[model samples]
Target: MTRAVAVELRGVSCEYRTRTGRVLAVEKLSMQASDREFVALLGPSGCGKSTLLKMVAGLVPATAGEVLVYGRPVVRPLESLGMVFQSPVLLRWRTVINNVLFPAEATGRRDAAMRERAMALLRLVGLTGFEDKYPHELSGGMAQRVSLARALLLEPTLLLMDEPFGALDALTREEMGIELLRIWQEQPKTILFVTHSISESVLLADRVIVMTPRPGRVAAEITIDLPRPRSGRMRVLPRFGELVSVLQDEMGIAT
Candidate 1:
């Protein structure tokens, strides 16, 4: 059976009014993520990759065209979606479990069942014993794990992650990618991830959507035919290198 479309952008454009006149961030860009798909948006800085993600979440208005989620037009902030930014953005004062419970508290669903679910999520992200730790006490990877758990707390159908692992050291970044895949497989939600790293995109995405420089649009879309349950060992495989090379070429690299 064909998978349902979870997120879509139809000829979407986003323009900002600035002192320097109108600045176009995204121009007539279109793309779709099917149900439970892991789609990565790959582009350089200022390419509007993050802008497109915001449009899907209804955080940013589209200048033209339509943004849709689960077949509904996105005119306001979507309730059934979660977002993870580059920074973990955890509240400094809240403990890890409280941070995970924050969304439920905001939505007035902070009950016994929700608290139980929050603990379960912390366990899912491998943070079983760190629930009471403050944000400053946790290392960068641990903190991002808390953020990931928090985002998944409500069990949103679609997850928008804007370069979520971009700030970590190289080794930690690779670990997070594998951990994310594990969580995704167990939880099974549609994910739209934004990243500037070619290898990271190739390792994490089912289909990599390459965006053009400024005023972003689709430059290419490449499907990663690698096997599921991906691990770091796969990175050394010839096929993995080939896919990374293709994405590099799409970004104007000659190798």
Candidate 2:
């Protein structure tokens, strides 16, 4: 069965007007994110991946083009969209559970139902025992997990993640990736993840959308045909190497 398209960018371009001149971040970029699909935007630092993400989140306005979420034009931040940034950005004073409940409280969703939902999300992210822990008391990875739980508290149909695991050590990053996949499996959401790690993109995305530098555009899109529930072991598979090589070539890296 064909899944519905959850989000789409039609002729999307982002231009910034500065004293110097107009700086183009993205140009005529178009893509579709299917329902329940995990898509990764992979490219170099100046590729406007984060710009595109901000646009999708309605935090930034598009210069020219249209952004649609679930067939509706996305003019501003919608309640059904959740975002996780590179930093955990948790409130230092709030406990883990309180931080998780921030979204609901901010959106006037603070009811019995919302509180129940927040607690459930904390449990989902393995923070059940750490509900009262402060952000400084937790490890880096644990803090990020709290961020993840907070993002999911809204049960948004669309989730935007900007290199959420980039700050962790390699081993911790790998573990978090696995944990993310597990969470995704349980509560499937259309995810647009931005990352510089080619391997991380290949591991998590159903479709890897590569972008060019500066005035970013779609450079290439390599779909991962590897089986679902991907583990670290899958990285050693021949097909995995093939996909990695292909992405590297697209990124102008010699295989």
Candidate 3:
């Protein structure tokens, strides 16, 4: 069965105008994500992975080409989209459940039913018992869980995540990766994840898009045929090692 296209970028280029000069970030990059597909973009530090994600989410405009979501041009910030950044930007004063309801409240969607939905979302992200706890009371990973629940409050179809687990410790990052996969399974969406960790990308994504540094463009595309409900042991398997090795080579990194 052919999956429908959920996102499309055509000859997209992003340039920043600064006092010094024009800096080109993404140059003529094109890619597509199928409906409910989990796509991960990987590259070095200076690559435009994050910029590309913002463009697709309508937070940034491409200096050239176009970005389309569900076949429509992304001309402005998409209300149907949800975004989670590196930092879990939760309000310190708000309790866990309140923070999760922030997005819905922001757009005036709050109601008895919406509040119940928010609680359910918090539960989905494994924050069921701590809904009333303040941000200061939560751990780093717990805060991020709140952020994830807040992002999903609107039940968006396109989810854009920019290194959501980049700040956590190695063990926590791995745990979050597994939890994210579980949430994705329960509630499907078209996800575009930006990350630098080769292992994390391989572990979560159906297809990993590798890019070159600055003036970022797709350098290689690796399809992971690994089985679903992935186990932690899968990362040590020979096939997983092979895929990671291929991605490392694409980045010119010695394994």
The lDDT per prediction is 0.95, 0.93, 0.93
TM-score of 3: 0.98
Which regions of candidate 1 deviate over 4 angstroms?
none
lDDT of 2 by residue, 157-196 (tens): 9999999999999999999999899999999999999999
User: Model 3, 96-120: lDDT tens per residue?
Assistant: 9889988878889889999999888
RMSD of 1: 0.8
* lDDT for position 242 in model 2: 93
Ranking by TM-score: 1, 3, 2
On a 0 to 100 scale, what is the lDDT of residue 134 in model 3? 96
Can you list the residue pairs that collide in candidate 2? none
Task: Flag regions of model 3 displaced more than 4 Å.
Answer: none
Instruction: Report the error of model 1 at residue 105, Å.
Output: 0.5
Regions of candidate 2 where Cα sits further than 4 Å from its true position = 18-20
Q: Which prediction has the highest lDDT against the true structure?
A: 1
